[model samples]
Target: MSRLELAAARLAKALDDLETVVSPLAKARESAAVAETKIAALDAEREALVARVATLEDEARALSGLTEEVEDRLDGAIAEIRTALSR
Candidate 1:
């Protein structure tokens, strides 16, 4: 072959070899990007769940306080009824 044709063939072969090496690296980079996106989504979900749990815990504490108040009133009423009956 002529020198120019030989040079072109060598350049083409080098490009093919480079592509073979770079193809897997490109795929690995894409997979890493996808994994990062999934991790971000999971983190957001976890934050929302943590906030919901905190709200539920606050509600539970308020309910406990209300329960105590109701019990105290009931006990006082029962004592008053017993005293009236004895009189």
Candidate 2:
């Protein structure tokens, strides 16, 4: 073949090889975009769960304090009964 024709054939072969190499990268880019979207959704969900947990913890703390108050009152009544019996 002539030099010019040989150069054109080589150029075409290089282009085909480049396309083969780039096809997988294109798919990978698409997959990365989807992964990023999923990650954002997960982060939002995690934040909401954290807030809910905080609210539950606050409620539990308040209930615990109420329980302590009731116990203290019961202890006082028991002491009064014991003193009366001692008389």
Candidate 3:
């Protein structure tokens, strides 16, 4: 082959190699963007769950105080009956 023709062939081969290399890189970038979107959605869901947990905890605390008051009243009634019977 003439030197000019040989040089042209080499250039074509190099262009094919570059296309193959760049295509996968573009696909990888698209995949990364999709992954980031999913991560943001998951983070928002986690924050909502945390808020629900806090509300449940507050309700449980209020119920605990009510139980304590009921227990105290029962104990006092029992003590008063025992004292009257002993007198």
lDDT of 1: 1.00
* TM-score, structure 1 vs. true: 0.70
**Every candidate's lDDT:** 1.00, 1.00, 0.97
Put down candidate 1 lDDT per residue, 1-87, tens digits, no spaces.
999999999999999999999999999999999999999999999999999999999999999999999999999999999999999
Root-mean-square deviation of every model: 2.6, 2.1, 2.3
- The 10-residue segment of model 1 with minimum total lDDT is 20-29
Cα lDDT tens digits for candidate 3, 16-75: 999999999999999999999999999999999999999999999999999999999999
- Candidate 3 segments whose C-alpha is farther than 4 A from its true place: 2-4, 78-87
Off by over 4 Å in 2: 77-87
What is the C-alpha local distance difference test score of candidate 2? 1.00
Model with the higher TM-score, candidate 1 or 3:
3
Q: List the candidate numbers ranked by TM-score, top first.
A: 2, 3, 1
Residue pairs in steric clash, candidate 3? Answer: none
lDDT of 2 by residue, 24-74 (tens): 999999999999999999999999999999999999999999999999999
